[model samples]
Target chain A: MSINLNRFNRVNRKKIFNRIERTHKTAIPQAPKRPPLLHPQLDISALTDIFLSKFSASSSTYQSIDCISLVPQLVLQYTELHNTNKTLVTNLQSLLTLDKSPLDWPDALTLSTPPATGEQALGLSYATTAIAETGSLVLCASKQNPTTVNFLTDHHIIILREQDIVPNIESMWKQLSLSAEHMPRAVNIITGPSRTADIEQTIQLGAHGPRSLHLLLLAGD
Target chain B: MVEHYKSNPQGSASNSTSGPHQTLFFKAQSSHALLDNTLQEALKKAKGGFIEKRSKAIADVENFESYKQQAQLVKNHTLDHLAYYLTQFEDNLIKNGGQVHWASTPEQLNNIILHICERRDAKSVIKGKSMISEEANLNAALEAAGIDVTETDLGEYIIQLAKEPPSHIIVPAIHKTRQQVEALFRNAHDLGDRELDTIAALVDEARLQLRQKFLNADIGITGANMLIADTGSAMLVTNEGNGDLTATLPKAHIVTASIEKVVPDLESASAILRVLARSATGQPITSYTSLLSGPRGIEDLDGPEEFHVILLDNQRSQMLGTPFEEMLKCIKCGACLNHCPIYSAVGGHAYGWVYPGPMGSVLTPLMTGLKQSSDLPNASTFCGRCEEVCPMGIPLPELLRQLRNKEHEEHLTPRKTRISLQSFMWTIQHPKIFYWLTQITRKVLTNTTLSQFFAKYIFTSWYNSKELPKNNSKGTFMEQYKKSSKQKKT
Candidate 1:
């Protein structure tokens, strides 16, 4: 539909335009100025421990499963600083074979793979916690590694840094604004595995996407 | 259509025995039996296709997150000033050569719609999938007044023929397997010896049947996803172009929508559009997202001659100043329902209302009255999955808890449960007495024979599917913590 752009006031329209421009220029603040990184050196093992602990406390019905065993490959980034341009295509191609070898699987699974194009793998960025309020994982998807990793894999494995966990949805917005320069293509706040109960009210997990989700938390890292 | 099913009475025997207030007790017993069957059947057939397709569609989009966030913000902003938006929407719609009707209750909405039907001398009306129309039971009302209304959405059409409410939001006939649907079609449509095994054939049959209704209808009725106050536009987002045709082909088009749908502009509408399709059907966008502003323009070729929007308040305006206002931000995406464990278990019909799932649980009581739906809030496992996936950020669990608190204050909880809680409170207040009572209970439970007997009779619900944890027979966790502290000091 063609909108009548002339109906809006020129001065008011300019103000809106100026605001948008200002927002674009100053969207992402420096890391230290933002919320402190809870566990700066959070790793896979520490994440697994926290996930098990949290899962145990929630329900007696849930069963614990090995998260790393489910992944295609564990890409341990030993970088001291954030790298936005590191591709993991060769590593992912090898990992896909390893991922297919597993026999028994968890009800939910997470996978990390390289972007379809030769873009840098969005390696697993850590959110402190998935918000209980909105089921959103507060991750800086701007880091190319994590962005590519989240989408390429059929299953998404997210490792949350314990200190980064926020209590509610409003805090997630706060964390996202902290780094504005490199907004990732997408920031998925998955609560559960992709599911649908459309067929006879029968919920089938992993219909078109990953049927499983595994959250690892690295605590005291 | 449901009246035809009512003739058997056996199917509705549970509902017939009780009034609306007592429906829960009947539902709880009958649905409890039905749930075991439904849940088992659901588990066997359950596979995650719908959500998977959605993820892939969303994964392809670069700006999907921004779209979701923008949509959520727009919905939040609109809901915050819903009263103002509704007024602006009503005013603008009237100004644009359309009529606006306000309905404070479902009864009023039904009467207003029927009055319009009567004035236009309408015999048949075509309808799109409208949860609000289901909420108002508009079809029954129209039918009771001797007007034939046909539901055109493929899923709704099947369920309408079966004379049952939709079991799921997006795929209304999701509960009916292909075999069950085949049986229903055979009986309803007189399809004798026709082997319709495939879903495509079934869809084609429905398409053929509904095409005539679309052309013959005197008026078309649909629900709006959002009503843009700035432009007097009513938006309908659908995978099929059925909504567009429903609104355009008839002489008069009537929209029935809750007041919360009004937004400020198209930019915000576009923002919401981003999330609505992805979260709902897992598509980048629905096949159709038609925005109709008043009737056909002077140069327009095909459109409704007369347009009407009936903004139903139906207790929504009452929520504006209250904490329940967050419920208004909902775009009816059904994401919460998809993620909800309780919804997946009992399905939508067991909730016994138009709206179902977590959102429905919160809304049914508020719109229907807390007295009628006291059990709705308590049905949740409080897994917090609904709140987690809700794009609009509705604090569902907190709302459910608040409803529980209201139920308690109103003495809506069962007397037995209240008495048990009261006794437990009394025991806790007296520490010495509580400790002694606990000691005796522990001693009794330590006896394997006694424990097994207690398991058999007292805690049947727990024993049915799961076993009780091995008790700390010696003492409680507090006692162990105290001993550990003493050891540390030493």
Candidate 2:
């Protein structure tokens, strides 16, 4: 079976290459340069504003914070408002490094970083980069930032530092390649909470992933 | 010849022997679809939403035309160097701890997947929306092997329960009414009068049911929107995060993609991304646009243990160096389907096969055979909405016209129609005879009694569905033209 499969692949590969080689010129055609994305030269403040506005256009909510310390308080407020459980799981290193002190956390709220199973209601992670053009958060998966945290939770909270905001997806890709050592297993660029229009074309949010997405935007670099 | 391929209700249940004869009998299928009140209601409800949303999304973009051009260029260039980019993609995916399997045909693709499943001892496989799998009838094969396969996407899950092929690419269950879905769910699930009254409730029910499947499934399969060769990542866009969950939660991950899906780098993928979501669903971007590279990293906390990508040629590689080569540039956004009058009127099922609508009409004949699906190319009204809306700028009408030419050349058209066309061609070659025939026919048509006699006898097929227009012209177009020119000269 393996040998037959190999022969099939080889025959196709040969046929395809020969066809393309015969048709294509000796000098390979270069990929055309893409025109610049929207507002390529916008300042950071303007970009953040655009990002937040576009993010709000989606069902997701956002808040501009002075620092990372304000995350837990907001999480508690969000949980209370929604009347969900007070349990929140996070893989954000800054929050973990802060370690529940100076950042006043309510005793009722439990916080821990474990691989998100179905039980986790809220999962917090940090975006490596955010695109202003589409209001998307780019999260790369690693040992620290598990891929499951992004999709497994019902309510996902993401931390986006102001400096991480890029003008467009192209810029975001450049920033990601420059920042990471190698491409992570999954680069999840999330734009909003999960939604579906499958049922008679009726748009419904929270199809299988997060019902709500909260972004705690850190104001400064 | 007409009887050689007939629509079999049991055709979709099997893979190997079941030909998609619905394509062959498209006229009958379309006429049948036209009268399906339930299907008509569903198609009516779906028709305007996609068009309105797509227009809004495109209007929001300042330079959408440039983006479309860039996307077209990227796909065209990639197709020209398909072998080069595919090799690069294979090499990079292997470097990223992912295995690449190549299959030249749909059977080979299915066998490769089954072999992988056998090796992994996978019992339950969760699949995201893969049109290629639908084309290969992978689920039927898996079930035949006694493996449990579940479609995780909401649309797919609904249709899977119905034991139907996808009516639309973006929304597989586009032809299914909500009440029909409710009935399907009530039958499929063992619920004691649970209320699935709202869309939200139905979605929640699917999530509740599929969650366990997500966690328990040994292998997950998904289709790639684009494959980045430089990074060895398969870019998947999903409004719901089912694709992400299906890819991440399972023990082994398999990406089902075509060879044309490969692009040179992340930037090219990004370029295509600009117009993909906007054209498909009228969103700036989907909720989750994941560039999944490989399986779990050595230091990663959680992901699939093994990653594999199955690249199916399936007559795609053969499309190269041909006029139909331009068809491979299609991104499967379904914009053409949304704007196509033929598609909106009859819906996708009438076209038959995995792909449907204008793009499907071009593709079904090419992938399947022109002889089998000869009617599909003629299904279009040549309104050209499909070409206008296609983001990749595929000349859908031209491709369909070419297919019609091929069908004509192959003598696949009906004998009576062929004779009429041959006579018409011979008459048109002689302008004087053609002019005289047209003048005599117009005079007869203007006379009500003669027109009625001709309509009943010679134009029976044309008159059956339509009425003769009220003619008010004094003379044939040539006579009028000659008279006006003569007066001007005098």
Candidate 3:
């Protein structure tokens, strides 16, 4: 059984708009004034510094990489540190075609592509933009970079391009508008690993998402 | 309605009921809550953390007040043109292969969700924390229809197991203690003498259990914090990531939001977001703030196949042009609840129904009739902290006063109160009698025997917990002022 949209408009919408028109007769609504930017004038290095500190404060860790090719090595190293035999699933084709392909990688590390079935313990993605104010990584979902690889993993490593770091959330919106579509189907602004302060207000990480979020800031971008 | 569901496994411990006029028993309920040691302990432990964290977060920002003003303006402008933006949101969402359903009442909303679940033959459903669902009594309806509904948020999961309504909005089970949670988990789960001591162990156990629920569920339901009108996307903010998992892993994703949640664009939504988390949980940003527009794109690897957004009006339309319209600006941050002395003392369950604290005082009377919840508006001390800390700039105290006025006008005020107020008004209007009465009262207070008699009998309630100040030997303030003026003239 479906709700009759026509009736809904006739009953609810009509009454609502009528009331609005009657009540707001003297005060016509207009465009609101935009607030001044919280961080209007910040250089790239300063933005990166703020981003790294704030991200680390959110229970996430990061490493500044001068080159993007070292991401796979860091992922392999992370797996070894954790001593887990989980596969590292990633959608970044650039990682595979970099200085060394997965074929030449160490036998201890296992690599797989996206469309992860909730079994991959490690997943990596490239953030479209990073916000310095809140230390958020904006990931726009696409065919190449599926959304599942972001959440269905124990360890999530994001590749943040140094040039892609925006000063604040508002500036990040402007950057997203410059893209081809109005907005991607899904844009996740993930900050820190999944956590909850629900049980007696004590915070615990790994609450149905990645336990640890490691950021690889690629300065070479 | 859903009577049995409200008073759940915990039974009389939680006095929250799901229908109208439940707030009529606010006096007895609040008294009981005051005596409930477990609830008082939980409230005490959960109280200072939110207030301190929020203040610290607000201080860290440069010109946080300017952000609050911008957010208030954004909400005002959107509410003024709500019809326009709502239709735009619907059109854009439909363009993106998503369907929009409207419900004018809670029953209609439940019916729409039930029909969708029934059509999909959904046997198992995983749900994120949604206040709208609580308002609609969706869980009871789904359970009655034989669907297994599991709440994935840790706090919501605990409350669901205990079968209790949320005491706090952002931290639903704020009234539950760690020991109480251990008991609930022991009763619900088949734990064979496994230790559940630390909060971390409880969280890990819940994660292990809910992870399975998230994968096998056919439908996932979530609440949208903001609906972007320009982009046709529903933005959900959660620290636990349960909302994202629920929205992504299922075959069909259902988002339930009130119509007032729509904003003009992503920029407007961001304007509110800057203040939303700071006011709610004091986080700069939640762990996962996902903007899920439609279902997965054609070539996408993983996402839901169907996306549906249900918008409920449910008396919100009537609030559009009323004195309470400013209340629609609320983002459900629970700041007012945390700072409220009344709420901090008696906790949320005493306020009855879904909402609590200063905002709930104004809302309960308005949403549920003013007569049934007349006591809610009178329950406040007019502390004004709620409005001061509110990110949306809602005048909560003034709204509660308005509700009180409405109650008085409707003759819902108790007879004794009305009579006493009328007598006070009459005496104040007659200055001669008022002066004489004040002089006589001053004389009586100066006499120790008479003062003791008045304290023991007349003002017994006032002297219960506090002592009266020593009476000044000098006369009333008027007499002192007159004497001072005469001396100045001389």
- True-contact fraction per candidate equals 0.07, 0.66, 0.59
Q: What local lDDT does model 2 show for residue A187?
A: 92
DockQ of each: 0.04, 0.54, 0.50
DockQ versus reference, model 2: 0.54
* lDDT tens per residue, model 2, B148-205: 9999999999999999899899999999988899899999887787898878889999
Worst 10 residues of 3 chain A by lDDT: A31-40
Q: Is the docking of candidate 1 incorrect, acceptable, medium or high quality?
A: incorrect
List per-model TM-scores for chain B: 0.88, 0.93, 0.92
Per-residue lDDT of candidate 2, residues A156-180 (tens digit): 8988888889998888888987221
lDDT of 3 at A206: 90
Worst 10 residues of 1 chain B by lDDT: B1-10
Question: Total backbone clashes of model 1?
Answer: 32
**Cα miss at B303, model 1 (Å)?**
1.9
Q: Name model 1 segments beyond 4 Å from true.
A: A1-221, B1-23, B26-39, B43-68, B437-448, B461-466, B470-475, B482-490
Per-residue C-alpha lDDT of model 1 across residues B143-246, encoded as one tens digit per residue: 88899999987778878878988767777876667667677778878676877886545655665576668778999999988887766768786644456557
lDDT of candidate 1 over A65-120, digit per residue (tens): 24434332333221112222233332233223223444332222223243322133
Candidates sorted by lDDT, descending order? 2, 3, 1
The segments of candidate 2 whose C-alpha lies over 4 angstroms from its true place after superposition are: A1-45, A93-104, A178-181, B1-21, B430-436, B447-458, B479-490
Q: What TM-score would every model get versus the actual structure? A: 0.64, 0.92, 0.91
* Stronger candidate by DockQ (1 vs 3): 3
